[model samples]
Target: MVATTLRSIKSLVPLLDRVLVQRVKAEAKTASGLFLPESSVKELNEARVLAVGPGGLDKDGKRLPMGVSQGDRVLIPQYGGAPVKVGEEEFTLFRDSEILAKINE
Candidate 1:
């Protein structure tokens, strides 16, 4: 069941106001050069934007532009968004407003 959901995510295109993001993996090693267990590693709120919607419709039915685009690194909220799994890769779909911030680096 999960295997089918993990295929062909590249064909996905988010609708208005939606953005697809892939969560950045936590580091398995510490600065002190010690290996950290999976349970000990903390999941960061950072992710890279994979695809963005055309933006939500305005009052007059006009499409607004999205603040972030594909390949942009963005900060996401700790919770929320619809989880997506693709070929062992996990992703999340969030509204533009739900995105916390954009990472410059």
Candidate 2:
């Protein structure tokens, strides 16, 4: 798979059940309209699916379809994804089974 800059993440293509994800930045302001300090802003466990790999082969050698697709919003684990760096951009890589859930919105 090609490592891509965050701005150019769209061009990345994952391989073998891998998934490319861009984390959603924490909100700058709260519901009450209070601006949070940079240090206080918590990173969210949410991310947008940037790219997906072709399904891995099964024991029978048949390709398994991925549960998530490109552009899907998903809930990721708080930790455990492999960190990916590209031209000052940060992203994460996870296996298809590692994805927690798909968000409807």
Q: Pick the candidate with the highest TM-score.
A: 1
Residue-level lDDT of model 2, residues 7-103, one tens digit each, is 6666668888999999999988999999999989998999999999998899998889999999999999987878887887788999999999999
Worst 10 residues of 2 by lDDT: 1-10
| Tens-place lDDT digits, model 1, residues 1-105 | 223454577788999999999889889999999999899999999999999999999999999889899999999999999888778777899999999899997
Candidate 1 least-lDDT 10 residues: 1-10
Which clashing pairs does model 1 show? 6-87
Q: How far is each candidate from the true structure, as Cα RMSD in Å?
A: 2.2, 2.9
Off by over 4 Å in 2: 1-7, 30-35
TM-score of every prediction relative to native: 0.88, 0.83
Backbone clash numbers for all candidates listed: 1, 0
Model 1: residues with Cα > 4 Å off, grouped in runs? 1-6, 31-34
lDDT of 1: 0.89
